[model samples]
Target: MTEIIDGNAVASQIRDDLTAAIETLADAGARPGLATVLMGDDPASQTYVNMKQRDCEEVGIESHHVDVDGDASPAELYDAIADLNEDPDVHGYIVQAPVPDHVDYREVIRRVDPIKDVDGFHPENVGRLVAGDARFRPCTPHGIQKLLETAGVEPEGKDVTIVGRSDIVGKPLANLLIQKAEDGNATVTVCHSRTDDLGAKTRSADIVVAAVGVPELIDGSMIGEGAVVIDVGVNRVDVSERRSEDSQTASDQSDTEKGYELVGDVEFESAKEKASAITPVPGGVGPMTRAMLLYNTVKAASLQEDVAVDLP
Candidate 1:
């Protein structure tokens, strides 16, 4: 029987664990605050920000939001970042990605105070992560480590193949798994689009993380027997197109009222058959990512407020 890792359960526990620390901070009159700065009106990004705000409210973290016009000048966005940096009420904040192309995302990240960079994308944070003295680990990668721990799938000496090289997931994850920590010490291979024979790499690993953003790129034949599979991609496919591709049944199509269905990089049914454990597209890594962001915000508040609190 294959174990289906429940990210919702794990994330809920993490939130519950943080409640004590949050209360401790509250007692000190330094309740954690997290802010989201959205530059454009991209529907997906807006939805994500909304969900994050709800998570903050659920955990007793004060939530704040700022919106910039889609056609706003880069300077206008920079002003918002500057204000967030100076706001004592905001212990941590993130400028939602996909800012207008005219705005250099890297420059925007650099402008954020490293101490309040809860997203862990700032150059200083990235450098600290690589140096093994990380102040903040990128949320997704850290969440992956937590999931592996909860699933009883230790990565200490296992081969981990991460199928993406984006800084957000791949680069940070590889750095993390190879570190000299309990969740670290894994032998990691980072694969990209140019990599030849991707299947061979995935098939040989004890754990495979599919994050390439391509829907159903990794299938059952590509996964090693008894290996752990973590799917991090959430892609929307038209129900009709998916049905035509034989990826969905008529009943499955009927369940989707939005004309589209969510899928991961790994083909779930096929990969589940060969895997010892696997995370589902909608219920796996997504919740963990949001949960970790809250974790970072709490940590940021603790550090800035000089309050020591236990973290999960």
Candidate 2:
């Protein structure tokens, strides 16, 4: 029997653990704060910020938001980051990705105070993570690690084929997994768009993580028997095939009215058959990302306020 990796349940447990930590902070007269700064009207970015705010509310973290016009000047963006940095109320915040092409995203990240970079994209944080002395682990990859632990799939001595080399997920995750730490010690292979013979690599791994942003790119034929499949890609694929293949799934998606439905890089229907365990798209990595952001915010508060509490 194949096990379905339930990221939501694990994230809920993490949130519950954080709730106790938050109460400890409250008792010490400190409240954790997380803020998000969005520079554009991109629908996806808006949705992500909203979800983060909601997660903060759920876990007793204060939420703050900042919005800038898509055409805002780079100076305006810099000033916003500065405001958040100087604001004593905002402990940590993120500048949502896809800031207007005219603005240098890297420059914005540089301007952010490393201590308040809850998203963990700062070069300082990234370097610390790669160096195995992490201030805060990147959220999505950390969430994936949590999922693997909950599923009882230890990465130690196991081959992990991660099918994306982006700085966000692939590079950082590989660095973390290959470290000499408890969550580390895995043999990791990072594959990208230019990688040769992708299927051959995935078929040889004990764990396959697909974050390439291509829907249904890794089918059952590409996966090894009993491999653990973690699909981190969330693509909006056309629903035509799904509508005809599985009416129930198509009906449930309901977003087909917009011409596309959400999907992961791996074809779930086929991959689950071969994998000992797998994570579904929306319920899997998504919830965990939000949960981890809250976790980071709480951590930032504890460090900044000098309040000592054991984190979950």
Candidate 3:
């Protein structure tokens, strides 16, 4: 029987483990704090920020939020970042992506103090990651590593093919898996839209990570037998759209109240049949991403407050 990797269980364990570290910091009179800065009123972004705030509260991290008008000037957003940088209580913060078109997201990232950069998109952090001295690993990639560890799928000597080249997931993950650490040392192949013979590359690997934005791009045929599959894409497809036989069953389709359903880069049902272990779309990488963000916030607080706390 193939193992369905349970991300919720693993993430819950991580949250539970962090509670002690958070309490330790609290004893030192320095409770860890995290902040979210949303520039526009994007509904998805707002929902994500709200969930993050709730996670922080659950783990004893003080939560703060800053909102900028959708039409606000770039400088105004920067001012909010500047204020957060100066606030002692806010040990870490993230400026939610998809800022106004007029604002250069890169410039906004540059304006944030690297110490409080919980999202780990700053040039300095990226550089550190490439150099294998990462102070903050990007959340999704770190969560993937933790998931792999929990599933007993060691990447040390295995071949890993990551589908996608975006800086957020692909580039960083490739860099991480090839490093000299325990979670590193994997032979990594990065594929993109222009890559020739994508299936051949994926089929030859011992582990496949489908992070490309396209929904259900990789299927069972592309996955090697007994290989581990990690799906990182969460896409919403129209309920009326035709789905493959492996997509969803009639009973499972009842939850599409929003006229859409969530899917991943890999076609789950087909891929699960061939893989030794796989992560589900909604319960797999999503929770891990959020969990790692909280981990980074706690680390940021520990570094700033000089508080010694054992991190899980």
Candidate 1: residue pairs that collide = none
lDDT of candidate 1 over 155-271, digit per residue (tens) = 999999999999999999999999999889999999999999999999999999999999999999999999999999999987766566466666686755678889999999999
Candidate 1 regions with alpha-carbon error over 4 angstroms: 244-256
What shift in Å separates residue 305 of candidate 3 from its native position after superposition?
A: 0.7
The TM-scores, one per candidate, come to 0.97, 0.96, 0.97
Collision pairs in model 2:
none
For model 2, how big is the CA root-mean-square deviation?
1.6
Which pairs of residues collide in candidate 3?
none
Best by lDDT, which number?
Answer: 1
- Tens-place lDDT per residue, model 2, 1-312, is 889888889999999999988998888888888889999899999998888888888888989999998997999989999999998788899999988899988999999999999888999999999888999999999999999999999999999999998888999999999999888899999999999999999999999999999989999999999999999999987776666645656465567667777899999999999999999987998889888898899899999989998898
Regions of model 2 farther than 4 Å from truth:
245-255
Q: What is the lDDT of residue 223 in candidate 1?
A: 98
Give one digit per residue, the lDDT tens place, for model 3 in 80-116: 9999999999999999988989999999999989999
Lowest lDDT 10-mer window, candidate 3? 250-259
Score each candidate by Cα lDDT.
0.96, 0.91, 0.94
Evaluate candidate 1 by giving its C-alpha RMSD to the native, one decimal. 1.5
CA error at residue 167 for candidate 2, angstroms: 1.0
TM-score, model 1 to reference: 0.97
